[model samples]
Target chain A: MRKFINEPSKVAQETLEGFLAIYGDQFAQVPGTLAVAKRVLDDKVAIVSGGGSGHEPVWLEYIGPGFADAVCQGDIFAAPAPQSIVRAAKAVERGRGILFVYGNYSGDRLNFDLAAEELQAEGHEVLTVRVADDVAAAPPDRANDRRGIAGGFFVSKIAGAASEAGLDLKSVQELATLAADRTRSMGVASAGGTIPGTDEPTFVLPDGKMEIGMGMHGEAGVRRADMATADETVDHMIRLIVGDRSLSPDEKACVLVNGLGATTRAELLIIARRTAWVLDQAGIRIHDLQVGDFATSQEMHGFSISVFGLTPELQKLYDAPGRTSFFSGANRH
Target chain B: MRKFINEPSKVAQETLEGFLAIYGDQFAQVPGTLAVAKRVLDDKVAIVSGGGSGHEPVWLEYIGPGFADAVCQGDIFAAPAPQSIVRAAKAVERGRGILFVYGNYSGDRLNFDLAAEELQAEGHEVLTVRVADDVAAAPPDRANDRRGIAGGFFVSKIAGAASEAGLDLKSVQELATLAADRTRSMGVASAGGTIPGTDEPTFVLPDGKMEIGMGMHGEAGVRRADMATADETVDHMIRLIVGDRSLSPDEKACVLVNGLGATTRAELLIIARRTAWVLDQAGIRIHDLQVGDFATSQEMHGFSISVFGLTPELQKLYDAPGRTSFFSGANRH
Candidate 1:
């Protein structure tokens, strides 16, 4: 493998150690657990999230003011242990209670729900909001069965903001659910990511071919076809997202053109350009546009497009200042 | 050729257009040049930098209030035209004059110097500071000939901070030079990056082999060796950097572990863990640590390490608030 890893089995632990070394001033590890929590806490609903370890800057790096209060990381492509999630929640539990906002994966849902049960038993009110926004993962009628992808970023942002604004746990959970409901995402993969210690990729694509709507961990996509130009690919993805959301003219939305592991920012920019054009043609106002590697799949070669149709309340929260190692929106509207 | 690009020749322009679409509220293009300037220019000396287009978030994305005032973009891996540089400088030039800070490359030097002369003739005081911190590119005695890599980030940050603090053009240039002098960087590439529209990579490496000290554009490095573990690779690179800089125990420095395109963040975090451990062994104080894709070679599967030795003056400046799309150090000391 071309990865800079020592022991494949210890990659996840070492990754967290590395992260703590740099961000230790603002965050700390929960004792006896692979959970990281913000150094300081306030008497507000605690927003917590996490999942597998391959996606950096997702759940861990997002732990800070105006974002997640804590995150419980798991092994590569695996779910965190229930105890770890409970510990993470307890680490940041204030009088207002705890709120969980995470992607909807079978393992993740099971573990987070179990953690919520434990926290409730311990006398802390807890609520769960699972994000399921991947349009290609299921039919519209089965949206709740779809896999959560990059659209979870919007859910996290809105939930974090609402919590930071002193919302009650139930209100925060409602806002997170609303954000998840309004968001839709689709990804195209030019290549697949390899797990550490593995010489082979999770999957393979012949040269000049690409897969549309591939999951973050190389799950089946909608289809495999010849590689298309950036404009064409983005146009197709946008169509699916817009149609899935039943978005209409005059709608205002926040757009995130996220790079899967290996895609270049330049390509993301090109994709963003087409995205803006298409949305404009449909009379959709882009309230905000972010282009970067918000969520990744190891070294996968592709990108995902996410649109979060904004309600006025969600828009206000989205515009609130958020500071994280990988993202910042302070002093801006 | 797995990139999502419609026309390889138009990638750079499209990248800029995409960037403008997202950031137009705060930045605007120069009337007749491929240059981006901040919409609001303070009376302080304007700090400007630019180079080839492949390194996204480097020159253009760095334009903001406490960062770069303007940036002139070139084609992929090519230098911006002198006229474009002049136009960009003029767009942000205030009565306090302008300062140009960029990498030390033959094409860049020729163009930026020509622009400085033109700006001088137009009665706008202009100063230049070329960053040559890539230790592997030249021997210590010929440091002036070294190529600038990720260390330019430190130079720009310091220069921008000084300029934003209302320093004169000469002072800003001097501080930039100091930052460049104290910074050093080296990279390892397991594979080469392919320029857009090109069928082949800029260079090639045999499978399981890696190049040490490789340049961003696949320039020849010091040596090729069998791929090593992340700890071993980081140790080798750190040894060279510490020895070349004559770094001593108790010295303070800021560290940047920059990912080339395609390197997974998990790998980077593992690298950072090793970096912090190694620096601790040397008794060097890490004043700050940043790990991300500050500079990148398009989809190149490798990373670079930059060490910026900090003096009290530079440390103060480094701690000052600066905001950019890819970096933000605001609301913190």
Candidate 2:
């Protein structure tokens, strides 16, 4: 493999070890576990999330004052074990309660759900919010079954802000779910990411072909067709997401254009530019905008576009001040 | 090329257009020029920097309240024209003088000097601080003749903090020079980055080979050898940089492991983990640490290591709070 790794099998643990060594001022590993949490815990509803490794700065980097309180980690691209989640949840809880948030995927659902049950059995009040916002994964009628992707970062931000604002556990959970409900995302993949410790990519695509609606782990996209221009790709993504949610001309949204690992910031901005133009053409207002590698699939060459339709409540939460190791924004609104 | 782009020639302008569209809240384009600046320029020494494109979030992302006041953008891997630099400096200048900061490159030196001459002729005081920290590019006796790469980021941060603290142009320039003097960096490349508008990579390394000390724009490295483990690569890089600087065991420094573009966080952390261990073994103290794609080459599969020795003055500037659109840090010290 052409990756800068020691042992492919130890990529996850070693990454966490190296991360803590450099940024230990901000975080600490849950004792004897592959989980990480903020160095200092606060007395509020604790927000926790986790999944497999490889998506750097996602679950781990979000742990800080206004974001996730703790994160469980698994092997590469695999969900954390339920016990790991239970330990992380237990470690970060204050008297307020514990709130669990994560992307909607089969492995994650099973593990986080099991951990929630375990936490409740241990006498801690726990709530769970699963983000299912990839519009291409399911129709509106089956939105709950859709897989979550980059848009979930905004949901986590909303949860962090609400929890930091001293909302009750139930209120925070409600806000997180609302944020996820208002969000929809779709992506196109120009190339696949390589699995660690191997000389192979997760999947292969013939040259000049783009996979529309690919998942974070190189799962099947909507279709394989000739590669399109950045504007054309954004056009298709916007069409699917807007149509799936039946968004109206009167609606306002916070738009995010996320790079899937290897996409340059220049390309993301191009896509974001097109997204704004297209959204304006459709009479949709952009409440806020962000473009970067908020979410990624290793070094996959692609981008995902997400829009979170903003109600006044969701808009306020979205605009609230927030900070993390990887992302931050002011409450300009 | 596999990159998501429209016309290759328009990549630079389109990227900037997209960036302004998304982040226009914090910055605006200088009219009729490929330059960007913070919407509000404070009455401090105006700091400006820019070079080629493709290195996302470099000169452009560093523009904000506590950072650079303006940046002149160039096309892909090319330096900005003198006219563009003059426009940016003139547009962002307050009553205070303007300071030019950028990597040490012949093209940039020629252009920025011309701009400085123009600014001086226009009755504006101008100072320049060119960073030359690439240890591999020159012997110790000729360190000033070496090229600058990722280490210049820390110098910019130091300059920004000093300028924000109300330092005059000469003082800010001195601190920037100090930062550049204390910093050293080197890199390794596993694969070459593809240039826009063509199917060709900037350079190619055969599959089982790795190049050590490659520059950001794919400049030739010190040597190419069989791929080694992450530990071994870090070992080689640390030996070269530490020995070249004649760093003593008693010196304390900030370490930065920067991704060229396509390297994953997992790999960066692994290298960082080893970097800390290796530095400790050499009895050098790590005062602060950062690992990310601070400077990149459009998704190239490589990383660079930069170390900045911390004097009492340098450490304070390093810990000073600064804010930019893409990065920020607290004054923990």
Candidate 3:
């Protein structure tokens, strides 16, 4: 695989090393651990999230003031070790409790759960919110089992804003869960990404074909079909996301067209245009729209559309400005 | 080539349409042209930068409150017509005059010249600064003839910040030219990008080889060599940029490692790490660091390193926060 890396075995450490080199002022490594915690500590509920290494600027870059407090990362496509999570949680805790937010996946969930227990054992209050927003992974009856994708951004934003607003731990947890529940997302992959040091792609699709519903880690998509126009693909994905969320005509929602990886901003903007048109035609009001590679799968050429139905309360939090290495918002200077 | 587009022919218009759909609140299209101008006008020298399409968020997304005043885009890899530039300038002019900043390419230079003439004929003041910072394209004696790569971002930033600081037209023009002269960049391309609607790539490289100094639009590079590790390639690139600029020890510079397209953020952060080390070893203080796909050749797998030697004055402007759709700085919010 053509990638810029020194050694495959050290991708995680090296990546973090690089991040720390430039953004050292904003993020610091949790002592002796593979976790990054924000430099500043405050008496507010701490929001921490992470999963793997390949998705740069996500879990780790998302840590700072007005964003997540800390992030625990694993090797490429692997969940963070539980110890890493515990260290990250402890590093950022200021007696305000901790909220662990992450995409819903078996490995991440299990490790984070163990880490939460570790925190609780230390007398630290901890809450977990698993974002299961990918509709293609499960039916509505099995929504909780669906894998999370880009919609986790919404969950993190709500949690961070609520905590920043001085909400108590329990209140922040409730808002995070509400935001997670109101979110839905679906993705289409035109190509799979190669794991570092591996020549083979995470998965493959036949030439001229695209897979809808592929997970961030290249999990099996719902189906494969001939590659269609961007508009058509977005139409299909948005239908799934909107139908699963089932909002009324006047309801407003935040729309995010996230590039998985390797997708051009030009193309994402096109997808964003189509998504807005489709939503407008459906009589749905758009609360806000963010179109970019908020989450990715290490240079995989694909994108996901995420919609978060917003209540007046959630909308306020969603609109709150955030300052992360990877994300900047409207209120940003 | 895998891409998300409707018709290849409509890629430019469609992409801009998409940008306007969500960011219309910030940018408004120049009537009858493929140009976008900031909606918020002020009694400051207007800074405008743009070129071909495909480079999402670059010359276009850079337009906002404290960034660029307007952007004019052409078809993929081609310069916008003079009429478009003229229209963009007219839309954003607020009596302080206009500053045109862009990469030093023949097509862009010619089109912008024509537009400047048009503006001058209309009794509007206009200044032009062509960024030619790619050290690999020419020797120091012919630096003015060298092609500009990602360093154009620095030129635009300095110009925009100067304009926002309420500098007079002539002073803003001088600062922009100074910023351009202080900048140096070099790029390596692993794979070429496909132009819209074309099955063939703009250029091709052997699977195990890379081209150093390759232009953003696939211009011939200095040499072809076997693929090297990220650190090795960056070492080669930084050496040229530093030597060409002849930076003294104890100097300060802003380091920017920009991905062309298809390069992972993981790789870029790693590159940023190495770049910082190299600069530190040279005893040069880094005033700021930015790493990402600031300017891209759509879906091209490559990256460029740009350094802008900063005087105390330039440092202040560099530190000044600017807000754009894709980039936000400390001054934001």
Candidate 2: residue A192 Cα off by (Å): 0.2
lDDT tens digits, residue span B300-321, model 2: 8999999998888888888888
Candidate 3 local lDDT, A1-333, one digit each (tens) = 578878888878878988888778777888776789888777899999999878877777778667799999988888999999998888889998999999888999999999999899989999989999999999999988999888888888899999999999999999999999999999899899888887688889887889889888888999998988999988888788888878876578888899987899999999999999998888888878888888988889999999999898988898787777767774211
DockQ-based ranking, best first?
A: 1, 2, 3
Chain B alone vs. reference chain B, TM-score for every model: 0.98, 0.97, 0.97
DockQ of each: 0.68, 0.66, 0.59
**DockQ of the two-chain complex in candidate 2:** 0.66
lDDT of 1 at A20: 87
- Residue-level lDDT tens digits of model 1 in B1-83: 68998899899888889988888788898977778998877789988899988987767677876779999988998999999
Per-model TM against the reference: 0.97, 0.96, 0.97
Docking class of 1: medium
> Candidate 2: what lDDT?
0.86
* Clash totals for all candidate models: 0, 0, 4
In order, what are the TM-scores of chain A for the candidates? 0.97, 0.96, 0.97
The residue-by-residue lDDT of candidate 1 on A129-222, one tens digit each, is: 9989999999998888999888888888899899989888889999899889899999999989889998788779999999999898899899
Quick one: ranking by lDDT, best first?
1, 3, 2
Residue A87 Cα positional deviation in candidate 2, in Å, after optimal superposition: 0.9
